[model samples]
Target: MKKAEVVLIPIPAMGHIVALVEVAKLLVERDDRLSTTIFIMHPVLDPSTTKYTESLAASTLPDRMRVVNLPNLESNTEDTKDRNWLNSMIESQKPRVEEYVSKMRTQSQLSPDSPQLAGFIFDTFATGMKDVANGFGVPWYVFSASGAAFICSMFYLQALHDGEGVNLTEFKNSDALLEVPGLANPLPAKLLPSMVFREDLLAIFLEHARTLKETRSILVNTFLEFESYAVHSLSNGKNPPVYPVGPMVKHVADGRDLRSDESNKYRDIMEWLDDQPPSSVMFLCFGSWGSFCGKQVKEIACALEHCGHRFLWSLRKPSSQKGKIESPSDYLNFQEILPEGFLDRTLEIGKVIGWAPQVDILAHPAVGGFASHCGWNSILESVRFGVPVATWPLYAEQQFNAFQMVIDLGLAVEIKMDYWRDFLGDNEIIVSSDDIVKAIKHVMEEDSEVRKKVKEMSRISEKSLKDGGSSFSSLGRLIEDMIDNIS
Candidate 1:
């Protein structure tokens, strides 16, 4: 029998791409017979996007895993912030993705013993792989970059919206909560994904929900210990096999060593951190797509000034000011986005860089707390390094992730679960500087529950990847199943 060569497709965003790369690396690491080729399909809106792909190709990867670039697709503008826009981008790439994979299959057929594509795995947005796999008679799986809870909610959103007559727009202001299947709690409309508002986005999610049910299995980047109820909900009935092989940063963090980030430019930041006391500094960073409006950035600056603790903020250009940003480095101009004297006020207590070496900063002993956008990958990284978090969700299903971390996992405290409240009109309520300061103080407190819980989770994250651990054995089962399908 030939080895199983799985093609993993990730949606173009930085977070989605990074998660798939890590999972692809893990597949190659755990199974000798598994070979992976990841196709990165990015829209060349920025030179930096292409540069990122090239960097991934250049990274030190396992011998069995390789990264390849898919040709850039046409960028879409309308509904750009809407989840539907991303879904449409992925759908538009289907023809090319299929053509390329079919060509690879045909070429590999010439070599009798060469590893053949026994399976297809697409991350959440790339669930378009279901049709590609079906068209060519190959098994496929959906690898959600988020927790099982969000995946489950997405799977059931349309039913609640259409069949249950839940008016999503009305629910935004109402007291109704989504009684989604598989989730233990009633999710407030504010906590639900933004897809509920528009019929087109709901349709996209519903299609993926249907596609997922037809797959061989579903994979989530969360551990069983962390999401037992949600995982159980997904595995029940004819929902396909649900594998909880995650807290993925453990497999990808290079054993929690700060040297994993080799970028030389951030050495000064690390050196500055070395002077701080252990677990004394706070770190604030949203994801690559995460940026605050000018109003929010100023509020953050005020928060840092009032907190009076050593902090490192990875500030990006205001997402609200999209058209004004002409270059990738525009966010580096703090003076432009920040208020006069704001930098001076916080200079003594905080360091604001355009971007910080996140993994390295979190791994450092001196850094204690993280104020995060609740991107699933960042949450896993924070837990991996035992850094407690202040959950500050900005958009999409991030609010759900915040709930999972703060209420379900006890690993993080909430800065503002409904951080997007102001997103509609830009005047819901500025999470006051006082509120931000309190949240950070709570996260960094000595003997805090968040700290203790995160430390324990760090140990569990390490253990879950070793032999006989749930993730380890689950990965083994996944490989064996893929090979079995081939034979």
Candidate 2:
């Protein structure tokens, strides 16, 4: 039997790269005839992302898998707020990718032992590679790091603007609900992604949605049981085939953890959790980019003290640089931002730290609930561990994910559905301590319906990965389709 290789192109961010690589690993494990090569496009500002790629390249991969780092391109990320920065950065890499893949094709043609190119699998933002796949005459797929509902919402947004001539910017302040396919409830206009407020961002976003129609398939990092309505809606043959082959979270049981290193502080966190009682602690972590102004930090401090729950908070200092994707860093002194006497008063009941072993902590018995930014990966991780989330979305498509959890799925309690971070200043409304306290209490309630729902879904999420389950079957179909397209 002839062997084949699939090329993977993921955005340089940690979250995107990790998810797509899991898909590659699964593909190779499931079929002996398949192999994968992940092309890493380095991010401009974050050294952490580049470092992660280095570690992955150094690690022992499966028999037929490899990670290739493309040559670094010097680029400016100073105007990151302009919305054109990401699109421009991704577009600029086209020549490098084309040249590399063109060379791979030539090498395969010369050697009979080399694996033939099977297909191109790209992260949704990297869809600019469509033309290269076209030139090479191979099928290309778009892998959504988000859920199926997000993809459906993207399609709906594009249709509303181009087909119906609806002005999307109006949704920023309008008290209207958006009725779209795939969601069980009518989506509040305010919960739409922040990109809708700006024409420049919206144009780039809609272009990606439009490009999905031209792909061979869309592979979402969600399971069928998780997003049945959205998956079924997209599979109606009007769009390309949609495959839900995930809930692709790290298996803590497999000894893989997301902690940065084996430092004493990281070790102390897990040890502290071990001392606490089961389902007693509220774990608060925003994603890598999540941070807040001093005033907001104080409000969260007030709530944590008032609620008096056993808490583990991963608090990061906001980056001082303006208009850049530089990730927030750890504060040297917690006293500078936190309220006076707050730390002393709650010292025994709470533990505040920078960065977290999120997968490890969630898997621990002591974690009762998660106060989260509702990043799709975080949502999946929380669900996998049966940890109910108190949604406090910061930006991007997180507000939509929060809404889906609270309104459509009834799987989480709401903190605030539409919280957009203002990197310029604190223009957004402040979420009061009272609201935070309320959400924490609701999520931690032992008999709460949301908690029950999450526990049940956790079982389903696990089952979906077993031999004959939903995600397992979807993955099988995706592999079969890719093999069938081999020329």
Candidate 3:
């Protein structure tokens, strides 16, 4: 039998890349006749994203699977705040990506040992490739690096806007509750998604939503039992199938670790955790799309200091770090950028570093709480490790994830629960030191309600991955279905 060579086009960001890479690994692990070629698009500003991709390329992956970085020719004309740039930049890569895939297909077909092009699998942001996949007469699948609720929300938003001619932005500022079928709690219109904030992004985001119907299936990075309502809402006989094969972070038990490449940077972090008592440290991290500003970082420093909680913060610089270099304040160390005497005063109690071993830290016994941006991947990781959260969302359905995690799952405490934080714009959030202090205490204090719930949820998360379990069965079916699609 001929093997299926699936070309994966990920959304060129760290979070999206990590999720789809795990899917590729899962696909290869379960099938002898399958292989993947992940075509990574070049990301903006952050050199770490590029380096991370390159590291994956250089790593020892399975022979049937490999990584290829697309050319860094994408234009950087658009400002980071104008997120339409991402949609546009991804759109601009279509002709080049299609051309590259066509060439790859030609070369591989000339060799008998090389696999036939089974299809293309793209991250939700790379949905423009749907046309390319159709042009080549092959299957295309969309991988949503979020939960089932998010998938339903996006598609439902498109249907609502296009079908009814309603203004989603208008609803965003209104007091109405969003009624997505699968979620038990009503999603506030204000917390819908960052794309709703800008009128220009509507076309592209809807492009992502509408194209899902054209694909063979929708693959989400979530488990079945966890998001049953949202997953169920996505299912109908006529619509594309939805599959859940996730909580797919890498770990030693899987004989693989995603952050192995960053082992050197994280070794120190692990050693620091070793010295702390069990369940004593609060681990703080925001997703790539949302990092604290210097002013906000200082506030966090002050909060950590005042609250007297032992903590480990995985800090990220703003994306436009190069632009900030003109100022003497933008230094190499976070300590350099922090408030006067902040580091010295809290040196023993809280350690703030520029990067961290996130999964490793969550798995560490000393980490009791996660003050997170509530990205779906982070939520899953925290749950898997029995770490409760202080929901502090930044952007892009993160508020949706945060609200759901707190209201729907009862696994987290709230930091700034009701509001939406745009991309450091007019309506951007400024979380005060006092609020942070309260939130951290709610998460880290022993025998808190959130902690007890998270511990229970963690057991459920683990059990779902076991054989004959809901997630396990779902994954088995997903693999079987993909194999059937190959024929």
For candidate 2, write residues 164-257 as lDDT tens digits.
9999988997789888788989998988988888888888889999998889899999999989989998888899999899999866665554
Q: How many Å off is the CA of 12 in candidate 1?
A: 0.9
Candidate 1 residue lDDT tens string, 239-293? 7898888876633246433434476547678777888899999999887656666
Candidate 3 C-alpha lDDT tens digits along 34-109: 8988888765445557777877877788768988777767374546556577666776777877888788789888
Better of 1 and 3 by TM-score: 1
Q: Which window of 10 residues has the lowest lDDT sum in candidate 3?
A: 322-331
In model 1, where is the ten-residue run with the lowest total lDDT? 321-330
TM-score top scorer: 2
Rank by lDDT, descending?
Answer: 2, 3, 1
The alpha-carbon lDDT assigned to residue 126 of candidate 1 equals 75
Model 2 vs truth, CA RMSD: 1.8
Candidates ranked, most accurate by TM-score first:
2, 1, 3
Q: Which residue runs of candidate 3 sit more than 4 Å off their true CA positions?
A: 43-45, 74-92, 107-114, 252-265, 319-337, 419-428
Best candidate according to lDDT: 2
Compute each candidate's TM-score over C-alphas: 0.90, 0.96, 0.90
